[model samples]
Target: MKKLAVIAVLILLAMPSNGLFNFHRKAIHFNVSHEKYVPPFLFWRWNERNVVIEYFDIVRNNDSIAANITAYLAIPPSLPNQEIMDIEFEPEPDKILEDEYGQKVACYKLKLAPNESLEIGWRIQAKIYNIRYILLPFLVGDYIPPDIKEKYTRDGEMYKIHDPYIQQIVRSIAANETNLLIKAIKLHDYVIRHLSYALDNKWDDAPTVLKRGNGSCSEYCFAYIALCRAAGIPAKYKGGTYLAELPPYNDSIFHRMVLIYLPNYGWIPVDMTFDEWIFHHYAFGFHSNRFFALMTGGGASQYLNWTYNSHYESVAKLDIDSTARWLEWK
Candidate 1:
């Protein structure tokens, strides 16, 4: 058990994301260009070292009859620069699921005797870094294939795609521009300039965020997503653990970014809140791989989709301790 704030409420909200990028590539379709990724000149710089994560949930049953509990948590997959190692869990999850978005999940179906307190934890080591993307501008088009766009672009209860305000904003951002990448960069810049960072007043949605002009990472990311979808770009949210909260974000680890599909690129990462860092050459891809991506989608988490039952109390949390990075979190 770490501190009170760091490792509690692991169960998280999901979100949506992107389109037009900020690059100067001419307008083009998905099939118009080949893969344009080139290794960055600086092969490697910072290694955030290894982050030990312990995800645990405490479930207390106060009822007389046996209490049934269903719990699920998101586990990140190991990617090229990002590696996952030494995974462990107690009372092993009843089952593991590979969600539609390809997230690896651990699930537990349990029966808690009356007055029993059940705790389950999953621990792992994450080798993290700043994931870099090719800096050269790539072609981003105005249209995305219907089959592809609908999956990420749909207006959900949180996205508020039907909002007239959001619709107008997206249109103004596009302004007859067909380059999806440029549009994305414009949206990124819009959020950076418009919204001042602050704790959310309520469940932050795009319209709400736009109206306030200040929000958490989720709010900024959601506002960006809403604008992208409205502009016909397929986008979705990326939820993760920021290795260490810096400057505007504070000590909170729960963080959010966006992933917009570019014409040639499969799905590139973007972080409106950290756009300045990218713009100033702080890191490539906006996401400094500094954060560990655990879940995606809207606030309705897919990680918890398998969890639901009668009266009970539950929360998800992670403990991240690191050195050299000067990071301390629970």
Candidate 2:
């Protein structure tokens, strides 16, 4: 395992292409380098009660022959407003690992016999807080700290940070603009005005959305990330299920949001589409009274793959839901 890890690192270092790489994609750009900045100490605070995430997965083997499968479950981290105090998993995760995206994840590998059913449970105990707008850093370092640089600043396949077209747009937006915060705000504004929110089932690369001028949450996130990266800013994404208790469409649904690194304040949430839809009243720097993060970063989750697999659909099924029934919101 150590040897494999070493080889992977070496491959990354030796690869001719510049910027973040998506193992699943086969595109690369040359001369890609990352940049950084600092933001003002502007922020607000909110509070959260009992916030919890749970998953009930049932796998059935309808095939005439037995089969084996591997799956992973995201273990919510203690982030911004959500603070996890406990975790419970039946037949507990086989083991956990820091995935390619740099987020810690729990994995479960199982085998089922023909005509058999396998059940799994995952739960978390936690409280949520509201620190919507990020403020000056509690921990400060050089312009863009290594910790932040490693995860958020780097590019991903979806971000397409090195795409020539994306680089041009970001450069045009930041022209003669030296202030980091202002640049980010400007980019946010640009995205709001440029793209119309049209839901797309598949994730689109940043350049594609920018050209098409319309896309859903993933598109918004991808476009924002591309712009940030082009301007030498650190950016990243978070995927989870947010309480769809708001206007327009009010039904439980899965969602995605972006986070950009600002000196001093660190990573700040940017829900561009949601913010604009509400005319920037809520969201943007912060979103939601309740958000259940299933995973973050740009990559695929093994568990998600299981659900997307056509073969698996005929043989198994997955069920997941999160709520805050334990905590008193009133």
Best by lDDT: 2
lDDT of each: 0.57, 0.61
Kindly list the per-residue Cα lDDT of model 2 for residues 122-193, writing each as its tens digit.
666777554455322222233776665665656667777788888788778886776566677668878888
TM-score of every prediction relative to native: 0.70, 0.71
> For residue 274, what is the lDDT in candidate 2?
79
C-alpha RMSD for every candidate: 11.4, 14.2
What residue runs in model 1 are displaced by over 4 Å at the alpha carbon? 1-48, 61-66, 113-116, 138-147, 200-202, 245-253, 276-284, 298-330
lDDT of 1: 0.57
Best by TM-score: 2
